[model samples]
Each structure stands twice: as structure tokens, then as C-alpha cells.
Target: MKVDLFDFDLPQELIALRPVSPRDSARMLVACGDEPFADKSVSDLPSLLQPGDVLVFNDTRVIPAQLDGRRGEAKIGATLHKRIDLRRWQAFVRNAKRLKIGNVVEFPAQVRALAETRHEDGSFTLKFEGEEPVELLLERAGRMPLPPYIAGKRPTDERDKSDYQTIFAREDGAVAAPTAALHFTPQLLEALSERGVQRETLTLHVGAGTFLPVKADDTDDHQMHAEWGRIEPETADRLNAARRNGNRVIAVGTTSLRLLESAADEDGIIQPFADDTSIFITPGHRFRAVDGLMTNFHLPKSTLMMLVSALMGRERMQEAYAHAIAQKYRFYSYGDSSLLIP
Candidate 1:
């Protein structure tokens, strides 16, 4: 499909800058085939699903990855796109032109880093030389790497320190949050458990590529970036059993859904997996896993919007997006969410 097929009008005012007071208080739009959209709250999720359903969540935590430093006299900014090791990282450098291998970029007064090597894709391998771990260094010297759209407006503040993270975040590695999962609260999880709905966890360290715009006209021409993910054997067995019991294997976010789809075989059987996935879901791509999806409002012309358009029909999703725009529903990373069942 053409990338433009998924494009829609989004008003700037509808873009959410911060999460609501209670995380689960954000609006939710539920969509099913040939049915009018249901406007609800994230807190209503527990009552919305059946007892035997299995909801898969991504447990990756967002890191404060943005950093500012100086290479010689030129000030250079950087964002840690992915962690390579305890001491090394792959980062996107702002003033990369002035940097070279062996150039040391001093982090804030409390931390220090060096541009050890450069990659062909304009990314650099940075090594930290501080007393604290890289994460600790980031916390002291770096800011939350909010998406460019919102970050360009206001500076990353203390509110983002809490608001940008999901309540269930545990396994730390992601540069971005699994936004759909952010709408969930501990109370909501307790409610789901009380209602007999089981939940399992998988980890997919979301990459900076999630914010990368699709530069190609045709979806096929675009290359999807790889992100490390893992699904335990126990979780796989439970998901397979859920399929046998005719229970929905609902994915909590696009990251979870992508990992689930990546771990499934042609026969629609899910299996344990620990690997990097570059699976790009476009229209006409048959889904092997994930019966339902709960996700945030996506950017127009982005890979995420294409995934949603693939699940629901392109025309139907277009109409749904129009409804969202007309109702002034929030859009993007800090936006409201949607629950879609194909």
C-alpha cells in the first residue's frame, strides 16, 4: 500500500502535551467491524474483556536518554538510541559533523563520555567514563527524550519524569514508552485480576526509530528498524492455551503486538522467542497472532498507523481517524488511546 493512504488531517491543538491527572482517566475509543466507535475511559478496560482472555503487555521502561555535551569547543547534543553494553552505547549525535573517532565529549559536570567510533548510519558508539552506570549518568546529565513534536515546544520538565513512564515499567531499556500500556494503572490491573482476566509480560525495548518518519512513498520500500524483544516459554504456553480455549490474545500496545506477531509461526502458533525483530506490518499482511489491540493514537503516514490500517480496513480506519479528529481526540505519544478488534 502507499504510505499516503493512511494519512489524515490532525489539528495541532489535539496533540496532547501531558497525560491527564490519573493515568487511566484518558479517553479511549473502541472499534469493531461495522460498528460505531465507543468512547470510553482507559479504566473501563477490565470490564470490557472476557474472563478467559489473555492480555500481553510490554514491560520495557523508558530511559532518560537525551544528553548534551561538548566535542572540543563545538557543543554537541546526543540521544542514546540503544544501549550496547554497561559502558558503551549507540547514539544519534546532533553536531555529528564536528565529531570524529577518539573525540571525547564531556557530559554534564557529574558525568563524562567519549565518541569511540562512528557507524555508517550517522550513529556513534559512545563510551562513558564516569563513576556511575550509564543509566545513572543519564539520570544526572540527560533529560527525558520526548518525541520531537512535543519536545520542540516546551523543555523536558519534572512532569515528564513521571508522566512519560508507564506504571508497570520494570525492565529498563526502552528509549520510548509502550504508550498504550501507559494508560494502565495498578488499580486497573487489580480490577482485571479480580475479573479473572490473566495478563502476561514481554519485553520490547522500543527504539528511537519509532519516531522516524516513513520517507518512502510505497510501504514496501520502507525498511523497518530492529528492536530487541523477548517472550518467555511460560507466557508462550499460556498464550497458545488461550488460543485453544477460544480466548482472545489481546496485545496491550503495538510493540507487544509486533513482538507477538514476530514470535508466531505460519500455523498461528506462538512460541518462546528472544531476538531482534524488523517485521513491518503493512496492509495485506496476514496476522498470525494478536486477536485485539490497545494502542495510542498514531502519527499520520507512520508505520504504526499503517499497522492499524492493516488490522482494520484502510477505509474504516480512515473514517475512525476522522471521527477522532472531529471529536478533538488527542494524538501521538502523549495522546489518548484506542482499542481495536478486527
Candidate 2:
């Protein structure tokens, strides 16, 4: 399909610069199959579904992955997208034209990395210099990798350190937050528990690729960046059992949805998985794992938009997005929420 078919115009003011005071206070647009779009609050999510439904969440924690460094006289900014090993990472760099294969970029706090390989996507592999694990080094010299939409509008502060992360955050690796789960809070969790909704966790270290626009004229031309994810045997068994028992599996975000689909066989039975996934969901794709999705508003002509359109019908999502825009709901990573059931 033409990428232009997924495009929509959004007003700049509708983009949320910061999250709501209470995370759950954000507005939610409920788009269910054949139902009129319903405007609700994120806190009301517990009331939106049945008791036996399971909610899968991505527990990948956002690392302080943004780095400001200097390659000789040239100023360079790097955002680490994926972890390759203990000492190496794949990063998208600004002022990359000034960098070469073997130049060591000197970052603050004495952190330095040798820019090793250049990727076809214009990203570079940076090998850190030291015995310490890169995770620890990042804590000292790196900053949170905020999406350009929000980060460009205003500078990220101490508040974003917690705001960009979800309560389910445990594993450390993701450069981007699974924005859908950002609306969750302890109180909201308590509410869901009271409503008898079971919870499961998987890990998908969200990369900066999520924010990239679809430069492809057609969907077939887009190449999704691979991100690492994991699903354990126990969790896989429970999800399968829940589905077999007629319970719906509600994916908390696209990250969880993609990982589940990656773990699923053709029969839709989920298996234990631990590997990199570059699943590019588009319209006409068959969804085998999830019954519904809860995610944040996405950018125009983005793969995220294509994913939701694939979940719901394209026309339905367009109408839903129109409704959201007309209602003046927030947009983007720090924006409002949406619950799509199709």
C-alpha cells in the first residue's frame, strides 16, 4: 500500500510536551471494532475490559542512552538504539559525517568509544573502551533518550527520568520507552487487580527507530530496525492457556504485541523466545497473538500508525484518529492514550 494512505495532518499544539501530573490522568480514545469512538480517561482502563482478559506489558527499562561527545573539533551527539554486547552498541549519530571507522569520540565523564562500523541505515557501531559494563558507564555519562518530538520542543529534565519510564520497567536496555505503558501507575494497577485482570511481562528494548518516519513511498520499501526481546516459557504457557480458555490477551503496547507475535507459531501458539525481532506490521497482516491493544497516539506516516491500522481497519483508524484530533486529545510519546479492539 502507498505510505501516503496512512498520512494525517496533526496540529503542533496537540503534541504533549510533558505527561499529565498523574500519569493515569491522560485522556484515552477507545476505538473498538464497529463501535463509535469513545473518549475516556486512562484511569478508566480497568472498566473497559472483562475480568479474565490478560494484559501483557513490556518490562524493558529505558537507559540513559543519549550521549554528547566530541570527535576532535567536531561536536557529536549519539543516541544508542540497541545493545550488541556488553561493550558495543548500535547508535544513530548526529554529525556522523565527521566521524570515521576508527575515531574515538570523547564523551563527558571520561567515557570514550571507538566508532567501528557504519550501517546502511546511517547508524554506527560504537565499541566502548573499558572493563566496566556499558550499563554502568551510561548511568554516569548518558542522558535519557527522549523522542525527538518532545526532546526538540523542550529540554528533558529530572522529571522525565521517571516520567519516560513505566512502572513495569525492570530489564535495562531500551533507548525508547514503550509509551503505552507510561499511563500505568500503582493505583491503576490496584484497580486492574481489583477488576481481576491478570498481568504478564515480556521484554522488548524499544529502539529509536520507532520515531522514524516512513520515507518509503510504499510500505514494502520500509526496513524496520531489529530490537531485542524475550519471552519466558512460564509466561508463554500462561498466555496460551488464557487464550485456550477463551480469555482475551490484551497487549499493553506495540512492543509487547510485536514480541508476542514474534514468539507465536503459525497456529498462534506462543513459544519461549529470546532474540532480535524486526517485525514490520502493516495493513493486511494477520494478527495471531493479541485480541486488543493499548497504545499512545503515533506520528503521521509512521510504522506505528501502520501497525494500528493493521490491527483495526485502515478506514476505521483514520476515522478514530480524526475523532482524536477533533477532540483535541494529546499526541505522541508523552501524549494521551488509545484502546483499540478489533
Best by lDDT: 2
Per-residue lDDT of model 2, residues 215-276, tens digit only: 88999988999999999999999999999999999999999999999999999999999999
Least lDDT summed over 10 consecutive residues: which range in candidate 1?
Answer: 130-139
Clashes of 1: 0
Q: Rate the local accuracy (lDDT) of all candidates.
A: 0.89, 0.94
Task: Show how many residue pairs clash in every candidate, following the order shown.
Answer: 0, 0
Error of 1 at 209 (Å): 0.9
List of clashing residue pairs for candidate 1: none
Where in model 2 is the C-alpha error above 4 Å?
Answer: none
**Candidate 1 Cα deviation (angstroms), residue 93:** 1.3
TM-score of each: 0.97, 0.99
Candidate 2 yields a Cα-based lDDT of: 0.94
